[model samples]
Target: MTSEVRAAVFRPDDERIADAVDLLESLGATPVPDPMLAVEPTGATPAPADWTVLTSKTGVELAAEAGWTPTDTRLACIGPATADAARAEGWAVDVVPEEYSSAGLVDALTAAVATDESVGVARSDHGSAVLLDGLREAGIETTETVLYRLVRPVDAGESTARAAAGELEAALFTSSLTVEHFLDAAAERGVRAAAVEGLADAVVGCIGEPTAATARDHGITVDVVPDEATFEALATAVVERAAPSHHGE
Candidate 1:
């Protein structure tokens, strides 16, 4: 296809960026690495607990850097990607929910650990409270340790210009913060309305439903969302929705 899809990956630089870029290229799309979020270590660590829960790969990286590793405690992750990130550090993951969301993680934990067990939820500053509330409702004690903070990017001027001129074909958001910050950036660039209209012309894909919800709330319609909340899955969703000729038609 002569019309190459260009999708903005609005996430911080990490080990996953390379993989996402490679996937987009393989699908005949240009992977725009205009990260809309910045990663900052929170100086917090996930100490050993009865059940250690990891919410994102960033958290796992920070916790490992802090000299924390999996002990006899069971490891529960919010998604398969997070689980893989944990296992990369030699931690045995005991739970990876099929749903791949905060609510799904709670169900996995409720089934894997007894109500009397303590759960240590490790994540960044943008971590959700759904799991904490869900665990509490399940009669499980939970402790949260912030491992990093995602700095929102409020200047998508370059991306907005490219989009407004029709040089962009798609955009991908991995988190709600990404959606929020991208719009904030667009407004700062004085192209919020144009960006919204441009995104309508391009394929807008999100990593999951929550991010998609945020995008819609901000008046940006989403075209694709993967069944699984992983970078690879998101890329696949974008490619499939874009219908690149190289994707076996």
Candidate 2:
């Protein structure tokens, strides 16, 4: 049997979807384009702070819509991709932690802020406020503004749902939203619990702990979690997990 890897990507753009495909192909897996969610930017608002934290490229795009420039404040990004987006928008990134999670970013920022420095965070309206909460506890005045919202795709196909129902070699999840949206889309397409059970036979590869936690909460067994939550790391984990086990030999 051919080891085909069908991924349910939530990104709508063809370029991003292609990137996911490319990443999967590099690991000797086939990429299936089934975006479960779409990202919509809400109107931007006035930013009020000396420093700004950006967790996603959508947040940066929203900042641009709000007439907010990265050069206007000290910019801190959660990871390299977000930092690249900030730099593309002419913002100078001052800090990007080794770990790519919100908690890691907060930990890095907690050490950066001394006293009386105000910071702003650009995030999704419904996402976690761990960074903002942590900054406040560290004595730094922090404000959070919603930049974008995630909505379920209008037409998640039945083929994708059926594929998810079968025994998957593995599934790679990038965010908590992906896990939630996948389940929602699956249900909308009438995929049942047996399909989710079939997925359990394969390794559940997550980009970070938070996403892994989300998977676990849904009763999905997470078999692999990358040490670093980056796209490259995710691809590497997929390849590594597919390798033959040495223990049984």
Candidate 3:
């Protein structure tokens, strides 16, 4: 007989949140769906290049919606999820690094791409400089096109409040931005210290090493960083760790 586990998820206010809620519930955790990130499309597509790199599923979907195509250019994705999104849109993914991070993209492209070839990186406005810098250092020409902007939703403080009140058993951070946005919300609510202190006792899960690093930088102890950098992995690991008695599901 396991007690209810109150877990917080900070995805966008879109199908992402719905899917995250479903996953948490299936794992027997009461999900606190606080949308921390909202996507605003830039209405600009990636420029034509020898190789085009996409870093997120949302970017892939947005590009598809804009009737964008590879047009003889090779497609590269930062992770399996982004690759899957592109594949679903009938785009052939040429490269997906085994590491699944900016550094990973840099290594993969550096090894495969020629210095003469140009790469276009399409992602959110908050995209990391690691990828672009890595490519540039390798002498490969790379350009970035902001596909969208990720903004903190106004109603994103519920999870921070829950954490401050010690009502949350776990928190799943999907990205570094989510961690920053969560802290921002906490600060805005005047409960940043309390929330960080409360989270010290609860399970904090980050989707990847970068997200975990961000959580730790904010004085939040991270307990889990799943091998796969995906929302499902992060949520499932957090729920299982927070409620060990209910693992069979």
Best by lDDT: 3
Q: Candidate 1 clashing pairs?
A: none
Q: Candidate 3 — which residues are off by over 4 angstroms? A: 244-249
Q: Estimate TM-scores for all models.
A: 0.91, 0.89, 0.95
Candidate ordering by lDDT (highest first): 3, 1, 2
Q: On residues 1-249, what C-alpha lDDT tens digit does candidate 2 reach at each position? A: 434555444455546667887887877775656665577787875377788888887777778777878666788898998899888887789999877877888889888866878898878876676777778888888888878887767775443455466745667777787788777766776674655776676656888888889989988888878887876788677656754451132
* Model 2 spans > 4 angstroms off: 12-14, 157-160, 243-249
**Candidate 2: worst 10 consecutive residues by lDDT?**
240-249
The number of clashing residue pairs in model 3 is 0
Candidate 3 lands at a TM-score of 0.95
lDDT of 1: 0.81
Give Cα distance to truth, residue 188, candidate 1, Å.
1.4
TM-score of 2: 0.89
Predicted candidate 1 versus true structure: per-residue lDDT over 1-249, tens digit per residue: 446778777667655667778888987788887677888887888866799988887788888888887776888888777888888999898888888899998888888888567888888888777888998899888888888888865444467767766667788888898888877777787888888998898888998888999899988989899887877788887876776553454
